[model samples]
Target chain A: MPDDAAGRPPVPGSDEAFRALADPTRRRILDLLADHGSLTVADLVAQFPGLVASGISKHLMALRAAGLVTAVRRGRHQVYAIDADGLGRALAPWAARYEAYWAEALTRLRAASTGTAGTDPRE
Target chain B: MPDDAAGRPPVPGSDEAFRALADPTRRRILDLLADHGSLTVADLVAQFPGLVASGISKHLMALRAAGLVTAVRRGRHQVYAIDADGLGRALAPWAARYEAYWAEALTRLRAASTGTAGTDPRE
Candidate 1:
């Protein structure tokens, strides 16, 4: 039922990636990983006092499933890190489509911020 | 309870935007709007024969709330178009954080495809 039947390859893992990113907690987790480079569930749980180990574990599972993160067994702890390559592979094509739009939007934003649209600098 | 209390301004509407993008049907709707520039509910419904107008309407509503689309009343129809500026504002910060990671990943990807990583050709 997907429109990809018209000869274009579907963006594999993109749906799972989007769904995984839908949670604020998960996005926060990515932020932590990006900041720390890698972390264990305990490390993450410590970062979010309001959340429990189980909850963080569940979020990590979703992130892993989405190919947004990778887990490696390190001694007694499982280390988790952002899977940058996997993330790019999963969402780049879809995200790239919006680059031109984003660029134009940013130009308009800068114009609004500086209050200097269509004004001659020499004037 | 959000982690933004420590002096960082939260990315507004990002949670809703991520949630809106989680659905394939909704993503397809964005693609349609991007391609066509604008469309009415009936126009969108006609694009997907299996989905009814109400279903597409709900998707549009979610997209609107996420600031991903804008609906305008023209004559007897409500027209929808991709709200590029809004979309940039909502997701740019969050997405920008991953730019470095994405760039490195792309470099690795190119190296992989061309099988020329660290191969000095001046030998």
Candidate 2:
């Protein structure tokens, strides 16, 4: 139910996001994009000696398809950057469930330490 | 460099976590476990009419391997529950990078919205 920066409906679900993040090489591409703000395919290829331009492009395509990164054509080069909101939309809800569980756990820990196990956690 | 509940070194990296989460059926199994607190293979199979106990067991094994879920032997059945800390350890660092980006983005947004784009974002 999330929307893109252009107000368009979201591209893919968490499954695609998870799939896109499954590869170490693809993750390295994301880290590069995060550090550089934006980079061209040539720039990315230069960073990984064993990787070719086509291989980098394919990874970028998967990232783009998952809405995890955005590519904009500036002149002859397509520069890519992390789509923070898109990534959040794909991951936040899933992460929140676990976070809530952790919060409750911490509350229980605090209560146990204080010898207030019978009292309300909020109190 | 996360430690498990037993204080052992983490079993897998974010790559395995992402791969394990990429499947819809596996995700559904996680959702069921989250809501129910814990479930056995037979219990999980009952939830999905088309899925067999073996299929659910396979999914549980993948989940366990990813450090996303924990299994405890209670009598003859293996009861599975969400391993929130293990899940967080596998995912937090990767998620934190994007979170930092989002935080900076919000700062920029606040600056732009207030017509004070020239000033330092932190200020």
Candidate 3:
């Protein structure tokens, strides 16, 4: 969402984001953050009964490294939240390459299918 | 897009999709297909000059395995296209969990930010 993003080279964080997304537990953590907006370590730890606080903390470290989550200290509490823009930005380059192409394809498909007797997607 | 997709268990190809997404070269190939819609093996061969068609074909095989690409035999030529829905559906389960959560967060943010002189996203 940067105002000067037009000419800027894509951030190198995409690879890290992809790597971060590989694990289910990490994905679950992101889901939790994105839903709740922000939470403390205690809040996050309570949700995962199967894993201890330290275990969740270790995964949070990886998430932070990947830029998928950000932690901020407010008084005595450290709050963690999903870096939503960071993630969407990280994947934007890859998604754009496909979506831009798909848009064009859809345009052509629409034009061709207009007068056709039978339109088949598999074709 | 299946009528029965609601009750159906998640497709097993998400892992394959994630694995396929890991490689830069394969991702590039998907970009080609996504942009152009459908291309024959020869059409795809022209795009990657450094790598021969066989090399590209190998990547395509992995893409096919990942359910990201589909091949249709048209006459003597084989046409390859990005299975857009397949890729989207494969990732939907993961994205949905986060987005559904994000929607709630946004609602809360909107309500709290309405009268505030300064809104802090990091908070």
Rate residue A79 of model 2 by lDDT. 86
TM-score of chain A of each: 0.76, 0.70, 0.66
lDDT of 2 by residue, B27-117 (tens): 7787888899999888888877666677778889999999889999999999999998877767655554555544444544455647653
Clashing pairs in model 1, backbone N/Cα/C closer than 3 A: none
Please write out the lDDT profile of model 2 over residues A77-97, one tens digit for every residue. Answer: 998998987776666545545
| CAPRI classification of candidate 1 | acceptable
User: TM per model?
Assistant: 0.79, 0.71, 0.57
Model 3: residue B115 alpha-carbon error in angstroms: 37
Per residue, candidate 1 scores C-alpha lDDT tens digits across A1-115 of 5453322225546789989988888988998898788999999988776777998899999999999999999999999999988787766656666766666654554457475
Give the 10-residue window scoring lowest on summed lDDT in candidate 2 chain B: B1-10
Report the lDDT tens digits of candidate 1 across residue range B1-123.
544333323666677998998888788888889999999999888877777788789999999999999999999999999998888877766655675555555555456647565422111
Chain B, per-candidate TM-score: 0.75, 0.70, 0.66
Ordered from best to worst TM-score, the candidate numbers read 1, 2, 3
DockQ of each: 0.28, 0.15, 0.07
Candidate 3 docking DockQ: 0.07
Runs of candidate 1 with Cα error greater than 4 angstroms are A1-9, A104-123, B1-9, B104-123
Off by over 4 Å in 3: A1-12, A42-55, A74-77, A96-123, B1-15, B40-58, B73-78, B93-123
Q: C-alpha displacement of B74 in model 2, angstroms?
A: 1.4
